[model samples]
Target: HSRGSRALNDGRDVVLMDADDFFISENLCSHISMHRDASEDGSKVKSTFFVKFYQKLHAEGWNLTLISRKPEKLRNATIEHLMAEGCGSWSSLIMRLDNQTQMDSQQLFLRQRTVLQKRGFKIIATISSQMEAIPVPC
Candidate 1:
């Protein structure tokens, strides 16, 4: 049986693999398309609406937090992109999905919300591309 099958069946086998192995190769057409979409230039253009919204929220004394499914390898790139889009203040609030946190977007959002609530911050709003990430009745 495959290691993955064994792990699933009995939880006894330990599988080791590099995180990079799961990412698409740079040469693949899909990877290229995704790279273009995530590029700094593309981000600057696509982020205009959100940037304006965030600026408005900031003006209204609301602190924004970013929760992303991006891997840790792209953390610096994410930060630089945020800074370029005039969101430097939010760089410190970025929460990225890394290898250790193997939770879905909804779980991650709930975890982050709990943590933030403990810090005395009332989470009045959440902006997410994925509707599943936002709990109903929130």
Candidate 2:
């Protein structure tokens, strides 16, 4: 909370981005989360800035909903990581567990896109970064 307050009070620009290597900098980011490894236990704390982002948002009446393709346990772990990383306590964040659905990335994206559109949300801008995994013959 103090960190975010400090950033805002200092007139720093708060940016938001997925947890990709491309967007990392010393700049103050308002929010950051893992994209490719969203479900991993260790990936939760791998933010672009710091956990104070969530704290600051909460202070400013921001309700953060964390959607995870991981199990309920891992989702909870992410929250834990947030707290440990400096968000203080993470009781304010909402966690949605998606493991039961077993949806792939494309399916999840389409479903979320439709739902968000129906909710009157529009995508203003999108920056795409592609990652591919190559098979190694044993």
**Global lDDT scores for all candidate models:** 0.48, 0.37
RMSD of each: 16.3, 12.2
Query: For candidate 1, what is the TM-score?
Result: 0.58
- Stretches of model 2 off by over 4 angstroms after superposition: 1-50, 88-101, 109-138
| Candidate 1, 46-87: lDDT as tens digits | 346566656565454444566655656677765666565576
The window of 10 residues in a row where model 1 has the poorest summed lDDT is: 13-22
TM-score of each: 0.58, 0.38
